[model samples]
Target: MEKRLLDYLQKILNARVYDVAIESRLDPATKLSQRLGNQIWLKREDTQPVHSFKLRGAYNKMVRLSPDELARGVVCASAGNHAQGVALSARRLGCQAVIVMPVTTPTLKSDAVRSLGGQVILHGDSYSDAYAHALELEKKHGYIFVHPFDDPDVIAGQGTVGMEILRQHQHPLHAVFVAIGGGGLISGVAAYIKAVRPEIKVIGVQMTDSRAMLNSVTAGELISLPDVGLFSDGTAVKKVGQETYRLTRELVDDFVTVDTDAVCAAIKDAFEDTRSILEPAGAMGIAGLKQYIAQHNLRGESLVAITCGANMNFDRLRFVAERAEAGEEREALLAVTIPEERGSFRRLCETIGPRNVTEFNYRISHERTAHVLVGISINNRGEVPEIRRSLATQGFSALDLVDDELAKEHLRYMVGGRSQLNANEQLYRFEFPERPGALMRFLSGMHPDWNISLFHYRNQGADYGRILVGIQVPPADLATFRTFIDSLDYRYVDETQNPVYHLFLC
Candidate 1:
């Protein structure tokens, strides 16, 4: 089977299905290579026209269709790279292509499909749903279904990535890190690499929340997941392809699952090293490399990490930016409650000292209670211990929110919607202690009639923190609110007219 697949790949290569040329002299970065103590050569798959390795397989499969099949056209389901590949390939081959994509797929992706002359059908809400709908269209219209990663032809075509990796690197390669979803890319790469250079290790990486391939391999059979978390949406497969799983089980060296946090950290690292913004899936290979180094205690070994693709949602960058430091263990979040009395808030601020307060969120509800949430930055993961010790000595109650999903996702969004209509509503920016109960003191100090209208706080780990607070004030009560704010002895900025707050917060 392996021999037949190899011959088939060679035939596709000889047919000149791809227009892009592969680079052979790519070099390893001095900083990254030295840090990992390995000669690490990146495959640079992102350099392709579609900025992914998908084109190789899509073209290889499409170009080999018989005249009858080509006449009937072809159909596929993809949200990003695969969709682009099939669209371009279909246009070049003079065949009609119909692509089914999830409704949640971005407009940019759908537009790209149309731009390449492919008829795109938006259906369902996920890749799996789109795929099922595509199957129905394939049967009804008699269009040839182009399998994204499961077919033999597709696997053979993707094997070209492994072939290029071997030809491009100079030093002896000890290991290769590949990201896994349905296992098409890794299966192809592993089959070829193990067949030719069996000594070289082929490790696979998957996001912990979407480890279909990893779980299947461990279970000794294909096991489908009911649902998968989609932080790395491109690689969020619930089931591994049957053939891909068979090849992976036999040829792949090992598998590792990295959490969302690790993937975020790897994205930052890849950007810093290559000035490239890798999507979470693209960064999986590098995250696996870090994990492999730590797990096996292997240092100074030659390795290669495939930087797969860069088709990332622009809005998702904000989430990545917010979590990168904490994912890397360079920042920590805490919820602290302090006494709701005069000078208590000031004393809490004194305890924070020069340490930067990245975020400060406060809400006052009850007559005598306030809840304050704060995030702080540290030099490294190791510094967390010292920071905790200091907070303990300062008599502040702290609850870490670094790994709290609820706090990160929902609680932060719902923090400041509480407001009672009052004649003395005012919006003030206050720098408060990050400790707990600090918010209660702020609320306690306010008059009973005052109501909070808007609140927004994001932790950036900075010293002398700032928080936006909205309080309801009647037209005649402005002086009273101003006097109350002035007595608190904190700087205040009025942003009731800020366009951003009005549009997003109000």
Candidate 2:
């Protein structure tokens, strides 16, 4: 079956598929190769017109359709790469294409599909929901449903990537790391590679939060997940495809799952190495490669990592940029509670040495205590343990939230909550110097009865830093609160009428 598929792929490659330029000869960086102790090669699938290997499979599937089926058109469900591929391929084949996508999918992807001449139907809240809707449409309209990574023809189409890699390389390939979602790409590549070179290792990578293929392979049966973390939306599959899982179980040599942080770090690495911004799924192969090399201590072996796609949302880049530093162990975040006293804030700053402070967020909710969240740069991964130990010694209970999902996803965004809300709340925007003792001076003059309701501060490169402070005062104490603000000797704006603070903080 594998040989037959390979033969069919060879014919398809020669007859139907475009001779996409092979980019295999590009040499790996000396620094990276030396660090990994392997001859690393990147398969630049992102260099393709559709910015992914999905086009190969889509084109192959469309070309083989009968005249009647072509008249009926082709339909599939996808959020990103597959949508673009199917749209472009159907247009090239002179057939109508319909793409069904989740409503949560970004507009950038939907626009690309439409631009490629595919009729896009936005429905449902998740990929599974969109897929079910697409199946219904297929049954109603008699349109061919092109499975993303499940069908045998699709697998054969993706197998062409492996064939190209082998043909492009002069040296023997020891291992190839490929990202797995529904597992079609890995299944095809593994089948072809194992057939031609049984000794070559085929490793599959999936995000730890969406590890359907890894879970299925481990259990020796197909397993479904109730929900998948969608950081890498391209590979967020609740269940591996039936055909792809079968092929993977028989052909894949090893499997690994990477956390979202690791995938983000790999994205930064790929950008630095190749000057290309790969989507989270595209970077998974590289993340898996790093883990594999570390686990087996495999040095001086030739390894290839397939950069699968680059269809990333521009808005997501902000989140990626924020987490990339901590993901790479170049930054650390600490949540610490300290006494709400004059000199205590300064003492906390004294504990942090020359390491540049990336972020500082503090709230004076309690009369006697203040909670401050601080982000600091780290030299390397080894510094984390030492930093934790130092904070412990300083009588500060510190929570290391460098890789904590709750902290990264929710806590950071909604840190200030209703816990601090009280009657007569006044929000003030104050600008202060960036030097030490600034916070101490601000807190020293505060009235003992008045309480801080909310506090938010993020350092932007500015001459004077701005902070939002919410203070609660009794109705009778309005005059006293005004006097307190006047005594602080800082310009303040009353945000009591701001709708955002009233709705969220109140």
Error of 2 at 341 (Å): 4.7
lDDT of candidate 1 vs native? 0.74
Per-residue lDDT tens digits for candidate 1, residues 1-506, read: 47755664464345343553244235475567877677667777767677677777888888889989999999998866788889888888899999998765656667877998999998865578778999999999999999888987888777878877876764578899999987878988887777667889999999887888888889999989865655676776778788998889888988888987888888887787788788788889988988898789887788888888887666667767877787778777766666666665676667777888887776555455445667777776666666667767867666666775545543456554543443344556666533456567778997777677666565433212346677787777788888888777554566666432322234
In the range 405-445, model 2's lDDT, one tens digit per residue, is: 43554345655575533677787777654455778888887
Candidate with top TM-score is 2
- List the candidate 1 regions with Cα displacement exceeding 4 Å: 1-17, 20-27, 34-37, 341-353, 363-371, 412-506
Off by over 4 Å in 2: 1-15, 19-31, 34-37, 339-343, 365-369, 410-506
Number of the top lDDT candidate: 2
Please provide TM-scores, in order, for all candidate models, with all chains considered together: 0.77, 0.78
Please report, in order, the local distance difference test score of every candidate based on alpha carbons. 0.74, 0.77
- Please give the TM-score that candidate 1 achieves against the real structure: 0.77
The per-candidate count of clashes, in order, stands at 23, 1
Ten residues in sequence with the least summed lDDT for candidate 2: 18-27
